[model samples]
Structures are given as C-alpha cells and as structure tokens.
Target: MNSITLEKWSDVVLPIPARYRAVITRDHKILFHETDMTPFINQDQRTFREDFMMYQFDGDNIISIVIKDMPFPPTHFDTFTDGTLLLASARCVRTDDWIQKNAGRYSLDGECLYKFVLGDGISAVAIDDEDTIWAGYYEEGVYGNYGWDEPIGSSGLVAFSSKGEVLFRPHLPMINELYYLNIQKANSIFAYYSLFSAIIHLDHFGRVQHSEIEEVMEVGPITIINESLITYDYHSKLLWSLKKQEGVYKKDKAFALKDQEGNDLYSEESAIRIRGNWLFVLNDSGIYRVELTMRMLEE
Candidate 1:
C-alpha cells in the first residue's frame, strides 16, 4: 500500500502502435519493430513475415530502417557501437535438413549484413563498444531445450565477437540460468543468475568479483541505483527496493509508483524494462519512465 512518487521522463503519446517490441534508450529515445503481433514467442506457429521495419524516434526526428528476410520475430535487439544493429529472435527449432538461424546483424538501412545462431530461449542480449556481444540465456537455453543436445549457452552467459565468433564462456557451474544483468557500454558486467542471488561483476580483464549485494535477490528484473537494488513488486505491481549501506543490508520494501500529478503507472507484466537507473514501462497508453535514485530506497 506504500506509494513512490516519480518524475515523468516522456510523454504518453505513443508514436508507434506496435508497443510490444518497443525499447527505450538511455537517452530517452524510443525504438521498436513496427508490428501488431506479440513478441518473444515463436511467430512460426503464428504469422511469419519476410519483412519488417525498425523505427527509432529521437526527439522530433524519426529514422526508419526496413529489413528484409525476417527470422522468426525479434525478441531482443541492441545497437552495435558502429551504428549497426544486433537483433535476434528467442525461439529456434530444428526441422530436417534446415536449421533456423535466428540472430543477425543489420545495417542502418536495414540490410541483413550477417546472420548467426544465438541458441534458443535467450532472455537478454547486449553489446558493447568493442562490438562484443554478451548474450544471457534462461533455463531452456542452458539445459538443451529447443533441439539443442548441447546448448550453446550452457554457461548461461556467452560472449561473441563482432562477427559472431565465440570469445569467452565462463565456468560458473552453479548458475543454472541467467536472470538479469547490466552489461554496461564499457564492457563491465553485473549479473544475477538462478540458484545464486549474489550479483557477479565481470571486468574486462577476465576477473570475477562477487558483488557486495548478496542481500538482494532476483525478485524480478534487477536494477542498480547508487547502493541499492530495485525490482518489481509482483503483488503491488509496482517498484520493490533493497538497499545496502556501509556494507549492511536493509529489509526489502515495495511501493507503488505515480507521476507528479499522482497518476498510477500501468503494468503489463512483460512490458517493464529497467536499465542502469531508469525504469521504462510500455503500454497502449505509451512509454512511461522513472529515474531510480536513493530517494526510492528510503520509501
């Protein structure tokens, strides 16, 4: 029943009606594939398409990139450092003779520059300035689901080069699946995985350091703010926060989110995305945002 007030970051005027595939950039811009269909699920069992458009809205300028030869519907996408895009689908199945390659790189003009297999049940995908791809998988991708006798993401985390070449795979036999991770643009990685609630920080030099926030678990999509960990409160359908100060942990708390006018924020379950210190919510109403700060932890 507790409520947290948030400062609005953007307008409710949704530019594209295809809200399911929308993504918000760190700078507050919006990007999404223009479609009316659901996302993350296999489209092969539904509507298959040979083409689609990716739209980016930056301020008043709109950039549209038309892609040909769509591979299942894209479940995750990230822009490369060199302005290209790394887009991939979630589900992949093997039929006789032909294998499904669901991930690919596309140019700004929407050309299919390269295609690769990122495995199945991919939960998250991120890229850094070095053009290194860090893909996180769920239980299915880690446990030989989707016709993969040997899942490519057996480690639950896989790093690939710009050309889809495997670069590094860590040996964390404890983690059964990757839950959430923040792979910063600088190649610094902070991840929360299954069976282990402790956050792991992976540096560029191949060193591993378990973070100090083991007090906080993957209750939902994880977000780091100052010295606190935040996720969603499934019951309240709002923000949940956990704080660590001076190496001491605080009890977890949940609170509802509202705008300056005290309007309630909408929750569509899968439409919530937390990045760095920002929370983005998508709905038919539009994209809403809130900044995560120390104040949220106090409430």
Candidate 2:
C-alpha cells in the first residue's frame, strides 16, 4: 500500500447548511450547491421546504451566492463548454400527477436560459466537449420506493443539445443514485457511476459503449485520470485505482490517506474533486489537498 499526504488545509465558508455538489470550472472557479431542508407535518401529509443555494469561489474567496426558490430542489448540475450552468431539479416525493418539467439551463448570473422536461427524476448531469449535455435519471421501482434496497425498475441516460433539444435517450437500468458524471475527453466518452456499483460508459452519440456492474463498495466520487478510474473508498480511507483488463476492472493500486504526522484521515461525509494532478478533499474537519506519491515495492 502506498501512503498519501494531505496538505494545505483550508476552510470554505458558505451560508448553506450542507453541500450537495461541487465542480471546478475550466477557469479554476469553484461552483457548488448548498442545501437545507425543513420538515412540515400538516394533517399527516409530510413535506419539506428544501432550499438550494449556489455559490462560486475563486480560490478560498467566495465570489457570488444565489439563493434559488423553485418547485423542487436542484439535484444535479454542471457547466457547459461556454460556462453556462445546467441544473436538474426533481420532486422529492412520489406524486401521481407530477409533471416532468424538471431541468433548466442557466447563465452564471442566475438567468434562466431554457427549461425542459425529462422522463424521470434527474440525478446527475455532465457536459461533453462538443457542448452536448448528458443527464442520468432515477426511476422508482414497482414498490414505489426510490431506495437502493428496493428493486431497480427502468431508468435512462439522455443526451441533449445546447438548444434544449433531446438528441438521444438510451434505455438503461434503474440507477439507485447517479452519484457522479464525467466525460473522458480522451475518447470523447461520457461516463457515470451509481450508488448501486454500476458504471455506464456512453459515446458522444449517446450509444452505450460499455457497462459494468461491480461489487458494492463505498465509493464517493469517481474520475478518469489518464484513462484510469480513480476513486476513494470511504470505508477503507484509501484511494483506489480500477484498471480495465479483459473487460473487467482490476485493482491497480491502493493509497492510504494520512496527515503530515502519519495519522489516518477518515470521514464518512467527505467529498472529493480532482483538478489536474491534485485532489481536493472536503470533510467535516476542513478542506485538504492530497498528493499521492507512488513507490515501487521492494522485494
């Protein structure tokens, strides 16, 4: 096992209760969403007032903040090639008469570019190099439950043009939670992972290139670094490399996380984002920058 170093600890101060999603723009700007929920019980009908706030950061300084009030909470978001924002909002509760007007394109200044409807609940979104937007949906199973323990019904992956036109919608298995979506720019493939340990790869044309169902692991976010899948295991507190061999993923490496003094760093509610060669980690303690150094094992 390789040892890792987490240095340059910093704090990101935001006004929201918790962070849901974060992304680094091409220009090194940090865009993130913060959410807060309030429960209300009225005549046995339970509902929540979900507040979603958007924030932008330049280094450690907060540049802008936008508190948005909408019919549903923003579930996933990404930036277009032109720096425009794409947000997907879906109803949290299962309602029979719910319409699917759940996604929107917006400018950085909080202006709505376009609004459109999807077939199911949108969980994650990504923008390809050609400016095409890809979205992942979470459809409830027969039990009328969206939890992972329930059966998986029918979900889908969608590709849309920048003009809000649906380019293609592919049939996919019911994903429990679309945790992360990324574009492997090397092959122009859009890839996404779900909480159910399913990884789906799609070409730029929205055709399925490969799909793999692996053993359940506590992986938070995954990124393709140099064509290899890199993700942090929440249970082991180690960074793992998954390389494809013979149409399956093989464990390439494992790097254990430690502080400068060699103390183990663990957190269950941590989030990770990779920019260039550095990995940014945020947990309940603070934000940290992790650098991985590999050393050959000596016989």
Candidate 3:
C-alpha cells in the first residue's frame, strides 16, 4: 500500500437543514457562495415545495446566506469580474425576485443573458473564460432506461451569448456537466460523465472533439482540469489521476487517505471533489475538507 496523510480542516455548518446538491465556485477570497435547499409539504394547500439560498463566503468563513423562495435547488453559479453573480436552478421557479434584489451589483442586461430555464432540472451550467454561458440538460437515452416503457427524449446542450441569446442547441441523449477548457481555447467545452466515469469534449458549437472513460479502481468523485482528470473514490479513499495523450490513455494512483476516527465518512452513493490540493468529502453530515499529498505509483 502507498503512504497516506489526512488532516481535518474545518466543518461547514449550515443554518437551515438542507442537502447540498452542488458546489458552484470556490476561491481563497471573500466572494464565495453556495446553494441551499429546503423541502417542505404544505398541510393547508397539500403541496410540495423547495427553496434555495445564496451563501456568501469570506475566506473560509460563511458571512451570510440569502434565501430565495424557489421551487428547486440551484444547479450552478458563476461570478463576473464586476462583482455580479448568476445562480441557475435545474428547473424554472415561480419567481426571480432574488435576481432583482441583486440587480445593482450586476449589469443591466445581466438577467437577459445570465438567467435561464431548462425543460428539466437535471442540468449543469458553466461560464467560459470569455463570459459565455453554457448549459446542458438531459438527453433522451442519456441515462440508462429507468423502465423499458419509460420514454427518454432529447437532452439539449445549449450555449448562450453573454447577453442570454441562444447561440446553439444540439440534440444529445444526455450531458453530465458543462466546463470551460481554458487550455484548449475559448471555443472548447468540457463535460464529465454524470456518474464521474468519463470526460467528454465539445466545441463552442456543441460538437464532440474527444472522449475518454478509462476504468479506475473504486470509482468516486471526478473533476476535469485542462487535459487531466481526477477521481476520488470514497469507498477506498483512493485518488486516481487519469491523463490523456494524443492517442493513448493512462491512469495512475495519486493519493490515499482514511476517514477520521469519529466521523462515519465515505459513502458508496456520495460524490467527491478535489479542489486545488484540498479534497472535499460530502455526506449527510455535511461537507468536510482534508489536506492530502500526492504519491508516486509503485509496482
């Protein structure tokens, strides 16, 4: 076995009880935000409802969480250089008041370009380095049949101009997520397999350029950086770094760690992410961060 080291950083305490569907953006600054979800059933009206909240983070600290009376949890978010932020939910809601309240921080045409609605809520969003908005939704047959008679329809991959005009929409069976390939150029987009098993490359027009899904041991959470892909399997606490070459593929074990003594960490169903040098592990208990060191693969 390879050597390992694990250091517990801090616990992110959420005020309102909610499950974190996704983590949009993170940095070493005071401008971080996250989406919070709340599920409630109205006894008077007998209806189900969901709510979303925008959290502002200040250097490893959560300063405030602005709640939005939305029907769905936010799927993704993007911040502009001008201090404006765009939050996108997987599905449409009954109100956009949250956007209105933060209007002054954003540009006049911000809503026209930054806001959106998808046919379904299983969507992912990303803003390229140039500020173009790219979104992806379920494509029919994208996810394996839930039932034989269950009909799956086209999952559309869409790109919008900075001003929110639909630039392109390509019919696909499904998409995992949208990413900006800064190393490739402004015209390329990167999406991962919904289950974090593979990476798909698309152009600005939603065209596939390349794909790689090499099998890794103990599959976990995966992230794409330029041409490199990293997967952190929670089951074994093993980090796998997959590298792609011109016409060849290879995977190498990068790091390994064990869960802390008091916490019942690692879940077969939960997702994981490696940001910078920190590994984020999320479960029903909330999100936890640990510092890890990469090791050379041994024979």
Candidate 4:
C-alpha cells in the first residue's frame, strides 16, 4: 500500500467531547457537535435539562456565542451554502421530551430560523448545490446493541428545500447503521450504512442511482475530491478511491496514512471534512488538518 505523510497544521482540543459529527463549512469554518455524554455529570442520574452544544472555530480561534433558545442538542450538523446551519438530533436513550423538536436551521448568531420533527432519528445530513438538504434516518434497532443486528424498521432518506419544504422522501430497507452522508460536486448524494456494508448514491433529483455493497471491516465518512469518491476504513487506516464502474462503486486506489514521525494514524471513530487542498480530521484526541496532494495514475 502507498503511504502518505500527514503534517499537522493546527490542532485544537475541544472543551467537550465532539463525538457526534464534525465538518468544515464552505466558508472555511470548522463546526462540531458535542455528544450527549458531555452534558450530564452522571449518566444514570440525569436531570435532562442540559441542551446539546455546537462549537465553531475560525482558523485556530474559537467563536464564542451563548445559545439560549435551542430546543434540543444537535447530534449532526452542516452549514448551508448561504451560511445557515442545519442541525439534527437523533432519538436515543439520551434524548428527552425536547427531542420532539429535533431538526432545524439556525443562523450563525445562534438564532433559530425553523424547526421540524423527525420520526425515527437523523444520523447524518448534507447540503447540495441548490441548497437542498439530504438527511439519513436510522432505525431504533441500529442504536440497540451498537448496531450489531440489522436495523429493525425501514427508515429511509429525506430531502428538504431551503424554505423548509419536504421535497422527497424515499424508504430504504433495514439499514444497520447510517454512518455518514455526503454530496459530490456533481450534486449526487452518497450515504453509508454500515450494517449491510452498503453505500447508496442518489442523483440531484433525489432518485436512487446505485447501491454498492462491499465486505469491509469498517467504514467512515465519504468525501469527493476532484470528482473522485474517497472513503476511509477505520480498521485498516487506508484511504480508498471508489470509482463508478459497471453501475457500481469499485475500489480503485488505496493509500495508507501516517503521521510526521511515521506512526500509523488510527482513524477509528474519526470524522473527515475536505476544504480545498486541506483535509480536516477530528477524533477523541484533537483536531488535525492535513495538506493532501492527489497523484494521478495512467489509465
């Protein structure tokens, strides 16, 4: 396997654990949601009064803002093309009565614009070119036993317009777990469901174009670089290039990631966001920015 070197640019240790999700916005802002575990002192004895927090960073400085009007904590979030923030909270054991108003959009100043309710739970979401939002819902079973068994119910994908209008909703089969959601430059949306080891691709119109299933130990986030679909395997620490061939996504290239001192960089439970030539990785330890150089091979 080809090995790539990762030079750390800027590292920031979050005040709270950012386990839910993380992404770099279009305007070069870093945003991450603190997990439900960080709010309460004790998990067993809970007050249920704590609200989830979303933190933003511009360069290396943290942006300070007091969010007093948020209904619920955000489990996953992404910034719209127009700088608005879209937030979603999954229905889990940690969620309480406030979860009824789980999904919504907020301004950069921490003001809520619109709020909506989701049935099952939202695991991940991404915004497309036309400002359409694509969301992946997870079944209750997936949360049970840490997604060991197949998803109990059939929860699917949903698309919403910028004006908070439901554009389309498609029901999928028993998805074990929806790991992440991403949109390519061509406006095609891609979602990773770990239970079946599948990646479902939807076109700009929210139509299913293909469902590619492969046997892999672990799957993380998916990002499109130069029109190529790239995904990381947490177990192997290998970056794979997925190419569409024969109406399916096939692994084309693989690269192993290593730190400056040649130590293997473990990607377990890590989230990745691509901005220009930089790739941001967030894990339990800290946040890291890697300058990436894509090498083209002869066909």
Say which candidate scores most in TM-score. Answer: 1
How well does model 1 score by local distance difference test?
0.69
What's model 3's TM-score?
A: 0.58
lDDT of 4 by residue, 71-143 (tens): 5556667778787788765643324332244567888677778877543456666677678877676656244
Candidate 4 local lDDT, residue 278: 56
- Model 2, 138-230: lDDT tens per residue? 544222342323222234466777766787755655445555565534235445545446666665565544545354557755665554667
Which segments of model 1 are wrong by more than 4 Å?
A: 1-4, 12-20, 26-28, 36-49, 94-99, 196-198, 205-218, 244-253, 268-270, 295-299
The C-alpha lDDT values of all candidates are 0.69, 0.57, 0.45, 0.60
Task: Please identify which of the two predictions, 1 or 3, would achieve the higher TM-score against the true structure.
Answer: 1
Write down the worst ten-residue block by lDDT for model 1.
Answer: 209-218
Say what the RMSD of model 4 is. Answer: 5.4
TM-score of each: 0.80, 0.72, 0.58, 0.74
Which candidate order results from sorting by TM-score in descending order?
1, 4, 2, 3
Q: lDDT at 234 for candidate 1?
A: 51
Return whichever of 1 and 2 wins on TM-score: 1
Stretch of 10 with least lDDT, candidate 4 = 145-154
Segments of candidate 4 deviating more than 4 angstroms: 33-53, 92-99, 141-155, 171-177, 184-186, 206-208, 224-229, 243-250, 267-278, 283-286, 290-299
